[model samples]
Target: MAEQQKEMSFLGHLEELRWHLVRSVAAIFILAITFFAFAEQVYDHFLLAHIKPDFITYQLFCDAFQLFGIDSAFCNVSFADKKLQSIKVTSQLMNSIWSSLILGLIVSFPYLLWEIWRFVAPGLTAHEIKKSKGFIFIASFLFFIGVLFSFYVIAPISIHFLYNYQITDAIENSFTLESHIGLVTNMLLGVSILFELPVLIYFLTKIGLITPEFLKKYRKHALVVVLILAAIITPPDVASQVIVAIPILILYEIGISVSRRVIKKQEKNANKS
Candidate 1:
């Protein structure tokens, strides 16, 4: 048994990971089927809610602007006249299916992470596993926060900008079903993954792959990268980019602190051993 364990190859690990992925994918599909049953309701009430102008985010921003007697576009924004087109016969159907899958992934994210944890935890020492046990909750929390931020903040800005961007009065903005859903889903997934920075740093620190000093040393570079990411993910506006970058920068700082704590703990553990 000892020899068999010691002789485990890369293929063995890959096989194990494959099973974990299969399980995770199965969970997502099950959830997707559930969402698919209410596809129309999900599409209108949840996915397309941001484009309604009466979304909670829009209202709050409008009220905030009004309270201070400031003029803002959100104050007069209206999406009642807006419409989504389906050029292809199958576009609407495909979008509904894809959107359901994305929603499934989001809804089952915690379970997905739990599946990942089960795969990886066995490779770590008991102490390490115990220390990192909160990985699922923390990761899920960050992911949800990112999803909410993207939906309420980034999605609104992008939708507003694109919907109102008129080159000429003759040209009408007719967004396609695919394009609309694409933007929202991309933003949701991208930010959700980005928000897992601290969790990522903790793992890297545990494995001696990174240190707080290295993060500090490359802080400026990380800022540039974060800003670039913010620009790519958000609408082309300084305010929007800044808004997106602030939280990411803060996450990076928190990641550094997490790294420091991890390193300190490892050193203390080694000394005790």
Candidate 2:
């Protein structure tokens, strides 16, 4: 009888998890449909904005150089004639659907985190639940910050450099729509995930997978990894790589502090027990 009851409980948990996943997917689907409905505006105002020569990042760079009484390539850049080609018959339609889905996932991230919290809250103590009350908001904030940073700063610079760069005057830069969108989406998703390092550290610390001392001890190694990641994500330029690495290194330090706090809390709880 007890074995049958245990099996039923296991199945019940799975059912509950399935429902949570269903709701998350439904949220993404609804938002994706809405974005697809306004695909033209979304692409023009948001996704493709970085490709323009007059993007905010370029303008900021121009202005900064001017303020310092220096001439900059940013001031001379122009993208009025550059256009993305649709090489495949279904490229536009497919990219529209995929971009809408990615946007949907990004916009619904907080709600998805809420759903995850709801599912996991049942297994946590009151103290743990209270401690994590702001998890969704904090995580969502970091994610959006990363998105904006990549879209405005990283994407514009990368697009400008890659689209204009030529080994010689003979080779023309004609890029496909798929390639352009792929780069933007990948950077947006990748950097956003990277920004979750502190949250990930909190969980890892709570589970005893890593400690603050371990993080500090390997800080130099982490710097090398961060530089490599920056190189992968940013344009092949020292300035771009440095800009990307700074924030990630800051986040790593923040993660170390978070891990220390988690250790302190766990020790306190152990004493009470």
Candidate 3:
């Protein structure tokens, strides 16, 4: 079993943790300032890109459907005159600041993970630490992939469907700036965190809190939960829900493999000892 190198006083641990948190915050602050400098461009080009009818995702969807000789609704939608409303006087400025901060956190995630690992490494056994050397890179890669998947695939589809859906022609769709930003950022961050399932499962297995058999037994329940999560994150449409659920289900399967590997390694170590 892995063991701590040495015991540290409670205050000593707290102090070390404080410094790691401070550095992490400083990195986020620096990136936030940089993003704020180019706030307009970031908002227009990246954050609000889906609002445009000709965004690459929509075009991709159009092309994909065209390959089947089928027409896609994405190609027919237009957002030329549509504008997100700013009801409050401080809405724009506040939303911009918050959005930049969120972007900073997202961009600086790898650094944040490194800081966390540094803080935790001191208490871990050398073997454990060495084995986890790729934690930061792997976690960051999964997170960024999740962000891209959500942004390019889920976000635009949900946005277009929700924005265009109306009960009657008498009612017009007017989305607020704050609401729009909230939706975008939530989906980006939320899905990114969800992508850490395999990592989380690895640790859980290492701690003996869960095993491969347990995960396999609960596979059906996991599917139901994934579907529920998909419903929450996506617009109220079967196609959108299925689209979101597929990746999460894939992650859950990956987590199962991770758990199995962890159990096999543990058994091998036990036999060797």
Write model 1 residue lDDT over 1-273, tens digit each, in one string.
Answer: 877776686669889999999999999999999999998888889889888867888889989999999989998889888888899988888888899899999999999999988998988899879977888999999999999988888888878878888999999888888988888898888887889899899889988899999999999999999999988877676776787888899999999999999899889989999
Expressed as tens digits, the lDDT of each residue in 5-116 for candidate 3 is: 2345666788889999999999999999998999999999988999998899999999899999999898797987679999999998998899999999999999999999
Q: How close is candidate 1 to the true structure, as a TM-score?
A: 0.91
Alpha carbon lDDT at 266, candidate 1: 83
> What TM-score would each prediction reach against the true structure?
0.91, 0.96, 0.95
Runs in model 3 with CA error above 4 Å?
Answer: 1-8
Put down candidate 2 lDDT per residue, 37-95, tens digits, no spaces.
99999999988997777778899999999999999989988887788999899999999
Q: Please report, as a residue range, the 10-residue window in candidate 2 with the lowest summed lDDT.
A: 232-241
* Residue pairs of candidate 1 with colliding backbone atoms: none
Candidate 1 residues lying further than 4 Å off, grouped into runs, are: 1-16
In order, what is each prediction's RMSD in angstroms? Answer: 2.2, 1.3, 3.3
lDDT computed for candidate 2: 0.90
Q: Which candidate, 1 or 3, would have the higher TM-score against the true structure? A: 3
